[model samples]
Target: MIEFECIQCGTSLRVENRHAGRTAWCRRCKRPVLVPVNATPIADQPDEFPTPVPPAQPVARPYFEPSQPPALEEPQETAMPAPVKRGPIQAMDTDPRNAALLAEIERRGRVIAQLTAEVEALRQAAESRAREGDLLEAELAAARKMALSGVQDTGRERAMIEELNAIISTQRELLVEKDEKIYKLDAALRRATRYSAETDGNTELPDVPRTLEDQTEAGGYEEGAEGGDARANVELDEARRLAQHRSLEIRSLRNALDDMAAKFDRVTVELRNAVLKLTETQQDNERLVSELASARDRLREKEFEGERFSTEPAQAPAESMEPALLEESLSSPVQVEVRPEPVWATAPVPRPEPVRAYSPPVTTPASDMPAQPATDIQHDQRVLVDALLRFLGRR
Candidate 1:
């Protein structure tokens, strides 16, 4: 037997002298160690075997388990143990077969040691990934919470918008109703003016025609002219009174329209502000949604990598690691309940129509009948109508 200690782990190992000058793995550290040749003379050997085979490969040795537990700390690369030298090989019959066998054993030992190290590295990587997965799960939970809150906020905003829309529709209806009433009032006023003109025409029309046909002399003409002057004065007074009443009504209607317009403008401004707020909330909601999706995708990728790295039975099961929670969060839909808003067109406020004064036509029996009074009456009527038209236009 050849006795030697491992250079890396300092473990004592005993191998058959047939394995001399061969490399083997350390049972404790799993690193390759060179077995030194026996220094004792061949006469001291107890048993000898006949070696006749030239190309037969050496049999692989069975692996031995360590008596003690593996060390908790990993070996550092920068701090390697010094080599332990053993005595050189003793003089023997020079043979090519022994050299070839030793070389083969050494090569096999190196390959096994490299594979073992690779597996250890993979195991360490899997453990580190498991810890990262736990942190990702916590973050996913937080993101889910935030998304829930955003959904709730969006719901509230939609409700408020619905209420505003309802109010706007009602206001629109009220405006339409008011417009119809104003139009009806305008039509009624026009009918009343027409009827009054017709009545005045009926009253004054017969007198002028009768006077023109029956009067035959200058004395009859003078008496007719005097009577015409009195009638003209009465008509002027009636026209003035009617004008004042119509002016008051028009003024009141104009004030009402002004107030309604002011209210409508205020409502429009409020609607604009509400729309802007809704837009901002929607943008924020979209941003949050994108963030959630990205996070979900990242988590999925991490899960895939984790699955690939961890194949050991000793590692925790994927199901026990809260995959359901992640799936639930990712799969759950955020619903935004929406109710259709009524679109109501705003009606323009009705403006009061311009008032026109009506006058009956008058005729004189003779050319000698004084024409100055008739001309003055027509001029006064024209002035009053013009003033009323200006007032209504200004309003």
Candidate 2:
């Protein structure tokens, strides 16, 4: 440390050796001063004045004022008062009160610096929390999107299930039909075997008929008995094959339905978990928001306290004048302008009548009358009777 005195203000200054021969501004007077290459020790300097120097000591006392002391005393005293009056403008090294004031100012400065740091930390925390909230919100939106997709998937699965159920029902009906056909074929086969046993020495079975009607026709009776047996056997084989194929299809469809149900259940569970996470995130965001609000309130309170402390000395004179200003303001009467309500505001408004729906005018059909007046009367009576009967029947 290089200790030096500022020539401009005689303020004590300390700087590092690295700044030797460099020009720097004085902290006290804000004037540029050159830093010495070598450190200046306080002990080496002459004690030209007291360590706790008072600013307003006399420059010099008149040496020839021994005689006529009372006459010169008045002039000397008058001149000394000017420097005394300017005492507060100089350094405050002597007064205990000024020292206390300096200490308080320094303490307040430290407090302000600490508060600033705390506010910065709080701001950073709030910013981080806000970012976290945004991320959570985005996550929540993604969850909602996923949930919507899951719901759509579930609906699709339900529709698929319904289609499968319809298919299964149709298959059941087809199976019942096949069962009836098989029963009829077995009965026909039984009858054929009985006939064949009775006619064992007769002609062998012929080519299969396409339909029962073909075999039952009178012209086809010669070939009927043998052809009917062959046709029943062919139809029974076809029915059994179709039933087996249908059963395989139904089994595959059931497996597909079970797989879809499992997927639906898994999706449902995922959606539920997402909803729970969304709720928890919302709660955390709300808590952070409340904490941020409280922090803002505390920061505002701290700012207000700082402002009050800073303004206390300035407000002293204003507070002293408050009573006078209040009394003066009270002595005067304030004028206010009053406006009357508009005629529209006080008057009742007329309500419009409700409009009715338009109806088309009804026209009576022209009467069909004979040129003879007696015939016209009979025709009108008949028309009236028919109209009355129709209306009564409708009722």
Name every residue pair that clashes in candidate 2.
Answer: none
Best by the TM-score measure:
2
Q: Pick the candidate with the highest lDDT.
A: 2
Q: In candidate 2, residue 43 scores what lDDT?
A: 39
- In order of appearance, the predictions have TM-scores of 0.28, 0.35
TM-score of 2: 0.35
**Candidate 1 segments exceeding 4 Å error:** 1-101, 131-146, 199-395
Model 2: runs farther than 4 Å from truth? 1-92, 201-395
Candidate 1's TM-score? 0.28
How does each model score on lDDT?
0.49, 0.50
Residue 350 shift from truth in candidate 2, angstroms:
69
Per-residue accuracy of model 2 over 1-395 as CA lDDT, tens digit each: 57888999999897776788999789999989999887663433355544786699668866764565465544443343343444432344453334433444454455444334434433443344345345445644655565566567656656765665676566567657656765665666566556555666666655666787865663467666568767756765665676566667656666765665676566567656655655654554454445445444554554454454334331111232245443543353432112332332222211111111112222221133112223221232243334334333432
Residue by residue across 172-222, what tens digits does model 1's lDDT show? 676676566556655655665665565456544323434634545545766
Worst lDDT run of 10 residues, candidate 1, spans 343-352
